[model samples]
Target: MATADPSNSSSAFAQLTNILLAKGGYESDEAWKFVEDLFKNIDGKVLSSSSSVYKSVADGEMVVGLSYEDPCVTLEKDGAPVNVVYPSEGTVYLPANAGIIKNAKHMDNAKKFIDYLQSQDCQDNLGLTTTNRPVLKDVQIGDIMKPISEIKTLKEDSEYVIAHKDDIVDHYKEIYTSISSEK
Candidate 1:
């Protein structure tokens, strides 16, 4: 029952739909219908963060998580009684992006910084500090972190996600909020 701010691009529904679409490749329409059912099923169960979801689990407020991998890793490192499940149904991959501003006064510097973020050292440092997987190939994951290669992932289309994120967010607002309002 872990949730994000509906407007949080990090927790966009596009990835969910992309994942479900992968899972239901032969019947994408049904995949979308199932996603709607999923949101309804999860309506009242939403928790604000991975920690909140972990607290809910600890307090017996919920039985499972539908959240990111980071908190579970953090909790496990702290030795709280919890486990992370990379769903057998397959997980989703959505990378955080770093972009340079258009027409910036220091375009080269901006470009340099973005490039550094993509570099092996910076990415590995990011993994160590944040306990999330680094994008650079074969960087070791933190001990509690799930090795990225092991998870059967639904690789989302960056182009499509970039193009249609707003629509997806709006659709989430429409359906999920409508459920809450009705209830």
Candidate 2:
């Protein structure tokens, strides 16, 4: 198993617990306990994703990676022998949003691209072609891609990020160092 510091890695499960804790009104100690268990037993690399965590996994430098579903799907599609698994205890779904830059050099092109992405055709085909879960009604995803509604997602706590960002960062560092030190 491999783990990466959550601050710099989108794949890291740093805020994974917030979903569960958020509904309980930011009960962080419990959340920390849950998060700590994820890394407490890892026996692989403690590195940043900056060094290409996916590539390392492909090269067999790591046996398992705690990551979001997209890259894993892409890697497998590109011929890397890997499997995707959800945490047995359930996991969080962190949605990444996108926006067009106002100062982009190709403003018109950006607008067009965004518009195209929002189109019916794109929405209908999104699930099959991309890792993103489509927002449109009645779109079908692959059997491997579980429905978000069926997923056990931690409820989002709006204030948790603002209030606990530092604490979360510290805990992430502590977990990584503690695990790495064991090696």
Candidate 3:
């Protein structure tokens, strides 16, 4: 199995950490220890980038990878003999976001664009064009990707994650570096 390096891919690291935290009963101290212990014990690879993690799996360099859903689905569609599974304990859903810049010259156009992003046509089109799941229910998100409703998702404490992000990243890096050095 492969996991992303936290220094280069904070979002992926955070998502993975969030799931670990949830599975460990949201206990920060114990979760941190568990994460460190897993890294120390598992004969796993730590890829420098999240893309590398998925690519390693698809290319048969690694058997399992912790990566975001969309690319894993894409790899499966490309017939890489990969399987995508949402952790039954719980998984994190990191939805892509769009926001209009404040004081934009074309306020009306910006609003229209936001509306278009949420439109049924766009939502449905995303299902066909990309692995990004549609926000609207009863919309197709391709055959390989599971519907959000079907997945057991854990609610992340965003504020806490945000507040401790830097510390968390540093701690993870420390553990990773220590293990790599020992090897």
TM for every model, in the order presented, reads 0.70, 0.70, 0.88
Worst 10 residues of 1 by lDDT: 6-15
- Give per-residue lDDT, candidate 3, residue 63: 81
Number of the candidate with higher lDDT, 2 or 3:
3
Model 2: ten consecutive residues of lowest lDDT: 17-26
Top-lDDT candidate index: 3
> How well is each residue in 13-129 modelled by candidate 1, as lDDT tens digits?
433655455668323666656666877877744555445656676556677655566666777688767788776767776777778778999999999998998888888888777
Residues 50-98, candidate 2, lDDT per residue (tens digit)? 3365667777988876666777777776778777666554565555466
Q: Best TM-score goes to which candidate?
A: 3
Candidate 3 Cα RMSD after full superposition onto the native fold (Å): 2.1
How many angstroms is residue 34 displaced in model 3 relative to the true structure, after the best TM-score fit? 2.5
Worst 10 residues of 3 by lDDT: 19-28
- lDDT accuracy of residue 179 in candidate 3: 78
Candidate 1 stretches with Cα past 4 Å from truth are 1-9, 12-15, 25-27, 43-51, 101-116, 166-183
- Model 3 misplacement above 4 A: 25-27, 43-45
